[model samples]
Target: MIKKNIYFVPLFLAIFSFVVIAVALQLDTSPEMIVGDSMQARSFPIFLMILNLILVAVLILQFYKNQPNPIPLEKFPTWGSMILFLVFYVLTVFTDMFIGIFVVMFLMCVLWGEKRIWVALLTASITPALIFMLFDLVLKIRFPRGILTNIYYG
Candidate 1:
């Protein structure tokens, strides 16, 4: 039955990616808006969808070969990590993205059994700083205004 197949998730993802690719192709982009040799609005999303499909194919092949799941279904921590990602999203939407990153990183480290509080705190602190430096300074990209970003940019 379909419920028993290990490959179902990847197969379903692949099919969904195909649907997304089809939809992405329908996105309207003005010819005048595209600079010479520049990618269209839909290009990056379609590319990512194609990449997802390729990875799904690889996952399907791995499943067909009977490779054991790396994280067993019975592992509560693994499921908790998945839920934590949802929490991260909600926090990012309601609060600042950096705050979400800091909270999630610290919580995830502790959830995964990190014993050292200092190490977890360092991870929570350093990651957002590094991300800010990379995107704001190195890449010259500006993040949307938020609690910390407002203070920093102001």
Candidate 2:
């Protein structure tokens, strides 16, 4: 039986955010020449960490206030899909992020009962490409060059 007081969700978020904030604090804060006095790279991460912490706090408070009833154990499949998504997301660090995005997006869309194959395929392909272009090109952020990246670039 799925317990209503699902403390795990908020607890996990709080722990994860705390860890991320700890790591973010260790980020290099050396001044950048071009963006003099402007926000450094670490600032964005720190900002996000703060936001995550706030969100986690709110969720924890809400959970405590509600004390909702336990859901059916049959809902495990939904949780399984979420876990699978997280697994795939983590795997992207070892492989290529774009490929991971494509695979995860397609599988998740299908799992969520999207009927149009063409729509899913197009979305899975285009969305990652746009993200790659925006971050890699426009924002000048470099992505991890895994084995596939090495082969392609070489």
Best by lDDT: 1
What is candidate 2's lDDT per residue for 11-104, written digit by digit as tens? 7887887888788788877757866988876778778878988988888777777776655465655876887678687768777776777888
Each prediction's total of clashing residue pairs, residues at least 3 apart in sequence or on different chains, is: 0, 0
lDDT of 1 by residue, 41-140 (tens): 8889999998998898888777767755554456777888888899889888887888888988998999999999999999999988998999999999
Could you tell me the TM-score of candidate 1?
Answer: 0.56
Q: TM-scores for all candidates?
A: 0.56, 0.50
lDDT of 1 at 74: 61
State each model's CA lDDT, in order: 0.85, 0.77
Task: Report lDDT (Cα) of residue 93, candidate 2.
Answer: 78
The window of 10 residues in a row where model 1 has the poorest summed lDDT is 1-10
